[model samples]
Target: MRSDRRTQLLRRGRNVECASLVYNIIEVAVSLTAGFATGSSALISWGVDSIVEGNSAAFMVWRLHGEAAGISEREVLKRKKTALGVLSAAFSIAVVFILYEAISKFISGETASLSWWGIGILLVSLVVNPLLAWGKYRYGKLTDSPTLKYDAIDTIICEYQTIVVLVGIAFVQWKGWWWADPVAALLIVPYVAWEAFHAGRDAYQVDLDASVSG
Candidate 1:
């Protein structure tokens, strides 16, 4: 019975991660298109962030599936470390790209045009991302999976990015504050960098634990 329950939980976790991956893909396409259309640095950066999150979701899917397949404990640990390393690298790349885009906009004095599409998508994300995060958190705790927990935190960070980008776009539309867009993009940097640090640290810790166990 216990084994069956564990199997069920792993199945559910995979479902949630699959859903997250699909959503992130759609988000990337839409956000990039809207960002280019309106010249919004925030939207572009959000799209890049989505790519990073999508990769994380993919990693979780792989990890959960591997567990369900009864992979060796050592193999599982190795996969976990690899997933964390990839996640950290992906986030680091996002930070660099977003920073460059935001700073370039500021230096060039580029102003984004109002984008109802971007606003509309962000509003939808405000509703969608929280539910996904909640699902991840619930299953993460139930299954005692640190990777799922980390992915949940990443999802929450995406929610924060949505709010920041939405406000930036709103200000550009209403207050004519062109700088708000780049500022919002800049704001996303700290959050992404923080996550990158945590992922890297966790990966290193996992390596130490493995070495000691060996």
Candidate 2:
């Protein structure tokens, strides 16, 4: 790419950072409210995921400053792995707590409130994630930035996860399966754990420049 194109691409990526942040904040607010309204652990878990995603995007913005320059693919992969591992462990613990709650709710036969709020938030997610992903991917292609590309991937995954959870939420409304909501929430464990391990593995494999500061 020519110098002008590279500069333009960087500017586009910088603009996307703000867009990503906006999406993150919206997701967090809606998820938390939806989770509370429904008393659905899955919805709550999605909120948790949103928080971390926000942090991830924020960190990316910091790393993508004009002065930050570019990093090697290996370093980006390492950071990605670290992100996965850290988030996975956190999510796993949250899932376990939700499972315990599910068991208690099951035994007590507690009924949950049917919340359109949760569904509404999810619908918002379905739209926001895809749009953010499209933006991230477009900039990624223009910049050849692996981090932006990975963000796109993460957005897609989050969208899929929401869809999965949405099914459970919908089932709860349609069939009165309270257990289904939490069960769907726990279902994310395997995927989260898998991503975590890959993240940790990649992070540990890196050789950070000894002369550089963290």
Candidate 3:
């Protein structure tokens, strides 16, 4: 009975990870397409942000699959740490580029054309991301998986990014406050950077723990 319950939980985790992968891939394509069409740098940056989240989701999928395959805990931990470290580096670099683009837009006083596609995409994500994040969080707690917990946090980050992007676009469309777009884009940087720092820090701590144990 105990073994059966464990198997059931593992199956559910795999399903959740698979769903995350599919959703993120679609999100990246939609966000990039709409962003380019509308000439919205904030939207473009948001699309790039999704790529980072997608990579994290991919790692989670890999880890979950490894667990299902009866891989050793040590091996899985090593892979997880490596994946988180790489993602942390990617997040830092991405944040730099996002900030640069936002600043350029601000300085140039550039205005993006209104895009219903961008708005529509964000609306869909606003619904999807929160639900997905909550599911991951609940499962993570049930299983005591730090990786899933942090993965859910990454999804939460995506939700926040979606909100800021929508607000930026809305302000321009509603009141012609052109600065709102870039300003809103800039707001996303701090949260993303903080998340990256924590991920990196956690990965390092795990490595240290493993080293001491070994």
| Whole-model lDDT values for every prediction | 0.88, 0.69, 0.80
Point out where model 2 deviates above 4 Å.
1-4, 66-109, 210-214
Candidate 1 achieves a global lDDT of: 0.88
Worst 10 residues of 2 by lDDT: 205-214
Q: What ordering of candidates by TM-score runs from best to worst? A: 1, 3, 2
Candidate 3 C-alpha lDDT tens digits along 25-49? 8888988898778768789888888
- The window of 10 residues in a row where model 1 has the poorest summed lDDT is 205-214
Candidate with best TM-score? 1
Best by lDDT: 1
Taking all chains together, each candidate's TM-score versus the true structure is 0.94, 0.79, 0.91
Candidate 1 C-alpha lDDT tens digits along 1-214: 2388887998898899999999999899999999989899999999999999899899889988887777767777888889889989999999999999999999998899977777778889999999999999989898887678768888997898899999999898889999999999999999999989998998888852452121
Q: Select the stronger candidate by TM-score from 2 and 3.
A: 3
* Between candidates 1 and 3, the lDDT winner: 1
What RMSD does model 2 have? 4.2
